[model samples]
Target: MKLTEARQQFISNWGAFGTHWGINRTMAQIHALLMISPDALSQDDIMAELNISRGNANMNIRELINWGLVERVIVAGERKEFFSAEKDIWKVVRQIVKERKKRELEPMLQLLDKLENTEGDKKDKHMKAFLDTVGSIKKLSKQADKTLDTMIKAEESWFVGNLLKLFK
Candidate 1:
C-alpha cells in the first residue's frame, strides 16, 4: 500500500482499538498521527489533517497529554504550541498499562476487598458462595496487581527476555 494509505489505515485501526479500551476515537487518531509524523504538529495542522474541528483537536490533544502519551513541544521561534507522541512502543505500552491499572484495576480491587468482608455466616450456602467468589476474585486481582507492578518496574529487555523464556 502507498505510504499515505498505510498511515490512514493505521490511524483508523488505532482509533477503533481505542474505543474497545474506553478511549475516544479522536484522541487515538491524534496519537496515531503524531506517532507517525516526523515532527511535532500544531493544533491547526492536526485539525486540518484529521478533518476535525479546532476545538475537537484541542480537547483530544489535551487529553492525550494528560494521559502522558503525548507531549507539548515549543518551536524555536513559533509561539503556537505543538504536540508529539512518545513513539517508543515499549514506553507507550507501559504508560497505558500504568494508567489503566490505576484507573480500573485498583478501584475494582478496593471494592472486592470491601465485599469480601461483608457480614455473613460462612456456614450458610448463599453466603459461602458469595464469599468464595469474592475471595477467588480478590486473590486473582491481587496477583495481577503485583504482576503489573513488577512489569512496570522491570526493564524492557529483562521483562521481555524472562517472558520469552517462560514460553519456551
Candidate 2:
C-alpha cells in the first residue's frame, strides 16, 4: 500500500479499536497518527491532520496523557502543545490492561459483595433462581478479578501459560 493509504488505514483501525475498548475514537486516531508520524505534532497540526475541532483534539489528547500512552513535546519558539505516542508496545499494552482492570473489575467486585450478602426469598422459587443467578455471576466475577490481579503482577509472558494451567 502507498504510505498515505497505510497511515489512513492505521488511523481508522486504531479509532475503531479504541471505541471498542471504551476510549474516545478520535483520541486513538490521534495516537495512531503520532505513532506513524516521523515527527511529533503540535495541537494545531493534529487538528488539521485529523480534521478535528480544537476542543475535541484537546480533550482526547488529555485522555491519552492520563493513560500514559502519549506525551507532550515542546518545540523551540512554539507555544502550542505537541504530542507523541509511546513507542514501546509492551508499555502501551500494560497501561491498557491496568486501566481496563481499574475500569471494569473494581465496580464488579463491589457488586459481588452486595450480591453475596443479599437475603433471598426462600419462599419464592423465582426469587431463589434470581439469587442463584446472582451467585454464579459473583463467582465468575470474583474469578475474573483474581485473574486480572495475577495478570497485573506476573511478568508479561508468564501470565498466559499460568492462566491456561489454572483453567479447569
Q: Which of the numbered candidates is closest to the native, going by highest lDDT?
A: 1
Taking all chains together, each candidate's TM-score versus the true structure is: 0.95, 0.83
Error of 1 at 43 (Å): 0.9
lDDT of 2 by residue, 1-168 (tens): 998888889899999998877798898899888888878899899999899999999998999999888999998898887889987666677777778878887777787778767776676898788778878888887788787677667775686677678885
Supply candidate 2's per-residue lDDT for 31. 86
Per-residue accuracy of model 1 over 42-70 as CA lDDT, tens digit each: 99999998999988998999888888999
- Runs of candidate 2 with Cα error greater than 4 angstroms are 160-168
Q: Candidate 1 at residue 155, lDDT?
A: 90
> What Cα-based lDDT does every candidate model obtain?
0.92, 0.84
**lDDT score of residue 150 within candidate 1:** 89
What clash count goes with each model? 0, 0
